[model samples]
Target: MADAASLPRPRRPVEMSGTNQSKRRTSRSWFSRPWASRPRTGGSWHAVAWIAVAACCLPLAGCKTWKKMTTSEKTLAEERTYGATADQRIDELAANAKKAKASSHADQVEFTQGLVKAMLDEHDPRVRCVILETAAEFETAAATAICKGALEDPDERVRMAGCTAWRKRGGAEAVELLAVRYRADPEIDVRLRALRELGDLGDREAVPVLATALEDSDPAVQYRAVGALKKVSGRDLGDDVNKWREWAADPDGSTAEWTIAEGFRQLF
Candidate 1:
């Protein structure tokens, strides 16, 4: 009491007991525990798991939303929505050509023909083929013109379809168009189809072209020309190119004999 500074400061509040010290350590550990080391309740962890799952799925949902639509899908969507533009209408018709029939409404036919005419020069070959096919059903002057133009299509399948449609809508003009395609088309199958259609047309103007096809490098072409010649001219030269050439040289000479022979053969 005489020297207060040296009195040991009243034993520093009696220095905590061992049991109290353990209690103090436990209380501090509760407050200072790492967040990851803490135990979680079922409801809290379930909500956190769902949040993580939603976060992972968000990007996938965004990817689906950002994907570009396909051409057929776009066309179908346009079909379901009304007030389509002229180009869109044309695309719809072309895309649905397989399911569509020749429209019985004259006004509809005329309108579609006008649209098809406008799309004739489109870069897509599929569009051109569908247009030509639909046009053929109308039997209109514009259809004939479009079919004629299709004979020169860069695609062989389009050329074949055009030729078939032209033959179905036959006239002098159609026969003439087929004759040109038969003689000038670089594709052998197209030439053969043209020749066959010409024979089906039963036009005499195709004889000279058929005779030329007799000497084609492709034996199939040569044989097809033989069959077409037989149908058109009633001559059965039996695949002999030389004999066909001889007959072609003077086609007018043996008409009477050939016609009589054809009549007799038909009788049998």
Candidate 2:
């Protein structure tokens, strides 16, 4: 048995060394192929080209296309482009508002509401006038509030603009606000404007306010109040202040008479 074990040592024959040499040659051959030997140069170039192309296209896509804008966006863009300074911008908005009013363009009017509201704090009465004008175009609650606030502006022109806008966007609340302005506004012109708007509103609640306006110190206010009274009552009393006072003395009777007169006028 000892002799047999000693003989076994000679028979292994270095098979592992030969097998390892064969595997090394196979690996070398695989790496020597043209595709395998070349670094991925083309893929790197393609990636670089893609990056360059994206950089080139970025500027073109930076802003929204004109065709992509909605009606409101387009209008805002055009209006906002008019001026660099606040005053200039406000002037442009005013011009646009006048054009919109002339054309009866509701969309343009609506588009300017935000811009107008933003300028309410401007020190220039002209700018504020433009803001009120633009705001008055919309009959929305926000527009109502904006116009109502303008009534208290220190500038008479701004207060007058507020009255004008209030007339265009009249409601029960607007009627009450206008009546207050007509009675309490320090500027006679503002009061006159408010009185005219109140009459145009034709709210029965305005009857008392109009009657009080009849006694205003300014003859012009009295005259406009008489006209407003006619508008509200649907009767041409021809500036007879005493009769207006008489009618105002009885609110219930005045309202009833106005209602009957309005019914007849509408029927005819």
- Which candidate achieves the best TM-score against the true structure? 1
Instruction: Go through the candidates in order and give each one's C-alpha lDDT.
Output: 0.73, 0.74
RMSD of each: 8.4, 17.3
What TM-scores do the predictions have? 0.61, 0.53
Candidate 2 structure quality by residue, lDDT tens digits, 92-179: 7777666766665565546556655575547667777877777776655566667778888888998888888877777887888898
Q: Which residue runs of candidate 1 sit more than 4 Å off their true CA positions? A: 9-52, 57-109, 115-118, 121-127, 255-268
When summed lDDT is taken over every stretch of 10 residues in candidate 2, the lowest stretch is 254-263
Clashing pairs in 2: none
Clashes of 1: 0
Can you write out model 1's per-residue Cα lDDT over 1-268, one digit (the tens) per residue?
4787666554546678999997787668656887554435544787899999999999999768646777776667766785455576566776554344444556555655674555554666766677777778765556667777788788998899888987888888877788788878888888889888877876767778777887788888888877877777765666677777777667877632555466568879
